[model samples]
Target: MSTRTDTTSQAGARAPGQREPTAPGFERLDAEYVLPLRWSEYRTGDVLELTDYLVRIAPNLDVTVVDGSPDDIFAAHHQLWADLVRHVKPDGEATANGKVAGVMTGIRLARHRAVILADDDVRYDRPSLERMVAELHDADLVRPQNYFTELPWHARWDTARSLINRAVASDYPGTMGINRDLVLELGGYDGDVLFENLELMRTIQAAHGRERRVDDLFVGRVPPRAAHFGRQRVRQAYDDFAQPARLVLELSLLPLLAWSIRRPLRLAGVAALAAALAEVGRRRAGGSRVFPATSALWAPAWLLERAVCVWVAVGSRMLGGAKYGDARLKTAAHSVPALRRKLTRADGRPGRGRRSTTSRPR
Candidate 1:
């Protein structure tokens, strides 16, 4: 792989893996990849810890921070990260989902074809980082599993969600590795969706691109604060709208429980079934290594929470849409058929081609 200069900042003059003053005592690794860490914040609480992680990984990857913070906070972030990484404000007009704008800007500013996109709370060590980049060699998009580093009570409660997802299907994670050229070719995914990660994955698949879900490749994520976790309950349940089957099942959960109320044994059996499914998931894809054995016990509780929250999400939808950033977003994600139609229209345009000609090893 070859390195390219980052036109977004003067720091691009330095070669890939070049050490900056802030990143002392760490030698640059021989990996050829770029990491686009995209985030938007009105506050600066996580800046210090995130900066430390960036400094350590700066020597291994060409890092770019696409910040969507207010001017003052953005300036503060630039002052801290300007030397160790390319720091830039998110370009282009804002969208309903601000994170997608930052992600698009970071991809546009990325210096390499192999790009790793991550949220602020994601932390990748050298080994996992390298493996993600390597996997992108044969895939258009790579989805890795995420495990929280420090498991608080809330984190363990959320772990049950991941366990159930692992049992049924791949869990959607905070980070993904992508081939920049392919995403660009697809003209990027919709920025108006609530579940942006799922939107991106479906967009890739709709374009007939290869998407590799690496269940065994675990990445570390910083758990959200308890209060933040509390706020996300209904919003997280609303994401199920993206998958109709899941949405229907969750919507029916309360009614099912109510019907089973007359028979206590049936309610107990339902909870046991949920726990058993979570346990099966916990035991899949080496989940036992990163997920606690006790996480399965929380599955029934998580399901109950979702049973109520899904109704709240429905009410929010009926009122208008879910509140995201400064706007309300009605769609969770575009259906695959809808995305395919959009891709077809793009391909039919005079200057666009049906697919990108970029070569990838099979």
Candidate 2:
């Protein structure tokens, strides 16, 4: 890890009173391939626990925490983690989506070719972390599956969403492993998009980079507080705007429900079909082992919620955009063709626009 300190008066620079990072007691593992772990967060609640986690993984991987918290919180984090991991702030000119700025900065600073990016809540065990890093050698990106740990009611409710996603396709996880060179090659993805993950994935696809989605590679994630989960309903729905087909399907749901209201049997059949689909998703990719069976039963309810929230998300769009932290972002994600044009123009080469291939674990 680089010990060079930022001398510029930038947000990520060490505060005057902040202590310099100390050499910790743990010994680095003698592994042929070790990746850096980049964790991004604006404000974190579980500071101590997360520090402990960083300590546990310190020997196996280089870790960096790109924090964008207030001065007091930043100082506190530096105090706790400076000795254990690289703790820094987001760059002063971060994108509208601050997390992306942190991600970009972390990747730029990583010592390894491959790096793992994660949210504050995502927790990786040794085996899963190593597997993701190893898999990245064959593909440009690796997306692992996330399941909630210590499920609350809201957690259970959200698990239904994951199950449905898994049934139709792979679920979008909080953490991903990517080859640093690929992102740098593309000049970093657009940071203003609402669905940042999808934006990154699409950007890779636009550049004809290979992606791997490990459906059975389960990583534990802490569920958001109930109140936080409640606030995310419409915002989460707004992400579907990135996928026109899915957005169209969600937008038609309410009207379909109203049309079927007069026919009880039709409504029952629709609900059953939703549940059945969720069940199939629950069983796919060894999900039955990690996800609860009852979560599949919540599919109809979750779909109903999306049916209503999607309209609200549309309304927000018409009014300008949805609130993300302090910024209101309208665009969910750019189309692949648009990104391909942008990339081609950037490099002065005809973009191949090759379709991305997914490598699933057998």
Candidate 3:
């Protein structure tokens, strides 16, 4: 094993530990790879500086970068993209990096067995990548764990959210490894989705397919800047429309948390219970220790922040349309008073018959 990171792409870029199908512990089919990255000008310098390293890890990788920036910025990376050994660019546009672009890129690799959808900045090595590929054997899509090992205060605060996510076996939204034909057959991701990976995961699950969230397969992600956290948090909460149950649970928890604040003893007891649940959920999901156990103590604070964001997001959506970069997060669909389907008539009347009727005041 080498301690050094290779920053160049070559024909024979080595994938150590990516084993043969018959190799012990390697049950998945060894298939060719295609990667799609969504790019913009703001992160161009940082992302391109590391793409070479990405190619070294997947030398045979068919990497395509879909740019959402201007023509000039595209030109800047054009030569570099040309020089890179493992990138494929057939069509280009600024679709804001959602299902549309993802499908476009995935379409190019439809002939291949697998398509790896990723952000422009995510760089992973062979071992982690192999684990991800292996994990894909069990399901239609696999979401690898991407986290920051060492975190500052802002990231640790964010960590509480991640720990709770494990309770639902929620996939990390930054990257996806999906079977190509399945992606095509499933009609790709939902259009106009802000959280593309999250939407895709749920879409696959909704279709009666299994989605695996791989905890053993991990990748390092640069912690987001502190200033961006609140805006990003709000935007993410807004996208919780894709998972209504989660939104409902999060929304419902807020009132209880607030009420408990007036009673110190109750709040402590609730916090203690939440902390224990968080710990158990994390371990069960095979989550990393990136989220400190002590951080779970802030579950109330996390829930309150999310509740505020959800309200603001709902209000913004109702009042006016939201632009992607704007700090006021909004979704096209109104999330407040979430619409849940119960067995009932289309005319808003309760249905007749024992199976369809509801039981009340029995």
TM-score of each: 0.86, 0.87, 0.72
lDDT of each: 0.78, 0.78, 0.55
Task: Put down candidate 1 lDDT per residue, 165-219, tens digits, no spaces.
Answer: 9899878899998878878877778888999989988887777777778888899
Highest TM-score scorer: 2
Q: Tell me the lDDT of model 3 at 60.
A: 35
lDDT, candidate 3, equals 0.55
Residue pairs with clashing backbones, model 3: none
Q: Per-residue lDDT for 215-305 in model 2, tens only?
A: 9999999898899899999999999988899999999999999998899998988899889999999999899999987888888889899
- The parts of candidate 3 lying over 4 Å away from their true place are 1-45, 85-99, 206-210, 288-291, 320-322, 325-362
Report lDDT (Cα) of residue 73, candidate 2.
61
lDDT per residue, candidate 3, 280-334, as tens digits? 6566544644555576666656766887887766665686534475333234342
Q: How accurate is candidate 1 locally (lDDT)?
A: 0.78
For candidate 3, give the lDDT of residue 332: 36
**Candidates 1 and 2: which is better by TM-score?**
2
Per-prediction RMSD in angstroms? Answer: 6.8, 7.0, 8.7
Range of the 10 consecutive residues with the lowest summed lDDT in candidate 1: 1-10
- Between candidates 1 and 3, the TM-score winner: 1
Candidate 2 global TM-score? 0.87
